[model samples]
Target: MASRRKTAIRLPRKYAKDEVIEVKTRIIHPNHNGRMAYKDQGYIAEYYVWKIEIFYGDESIITVSASAALSQNPYFTFMLRATHSAPLRVVWVDTQGDQYTESVDVVV
Candidate 1:
């Protein structure tokens, strides 16, 4: 299925190693849980973004799991330590087996 999604994020342009930095993100998705759908279709089949994994450069940062209760466009805010100057990668997975990724460059 096509991932109709949009993501917004904020990160520090520079930081020190091990320094905590705030990160904010929001993703746009139909998040159609497929549990409720057109009467003729007998529900959409519960398709929604369920998991998200974050990576700082090659290092795995954090992972998150979500459910259909999430709003259509999910919002997330967290703190991550900058171990080095690298690009932060955020990948999200949906029930439809769709993946969405966003990246931010940071200098540590």
Candidate 2:
């Protein structure tokens, strides 16, 4: 994967009881496909978020499959239907066992 220039996220400050919430997220990383080398070593260790799971109140809302061509620090924007107040949790797992997580509070 290409390197992501920026890795971050943004969400609405508030939402209605049954409003559709927009969630945006980006990550800064070099999704090395484990086929390249920097200087030393025959190869560079693999690092990438192979899967991302987004959830609301423990219920999964969206899941995306990523690839190296997806670019480094991939950014994604999506919407989720929220019926009440809950916490949104995001979890990312890379091939190297690196785990990243984020959460947001949704108010209805």
Indicate which candidate wins on TM-score: 1
Clashing pairs in 2: 2-72, 3-72, 4-72, 7-26, 7-27, 8-26, 27-73
Please provide, for model 1 over 60-97, each residue's C-alpha lDDT reduced to its tens digit, 9 standing for 90 to 100: 87888987888888878899877777888889899979
- TM-score for each predicted model, relative to the true structure: 0.81, 0.78
- The lDDT of each candidate is 0.82, 0.76
Tens-digit lDDT track of model 2 for 1-108: 356434455778877777787889876667887778768858876777789888889788789878655677777889877787788787777787887887777777
Give the range where candidate 2 is weakest over 10 consecutive residues by summed lDDT: 1-10
Under the 3 Å rule for N, CA and C atoms, how many clashes does model 2 have? 7
Clashing pairs in 1: 33-46, 33-47, 34-44, 34-45, 34-46
What TM value does model 2 have? Answer: 0.78
Please list the Cα RMSD from the true structure of every candidate, rounded to 1 decimal place: 3.3, 4.4
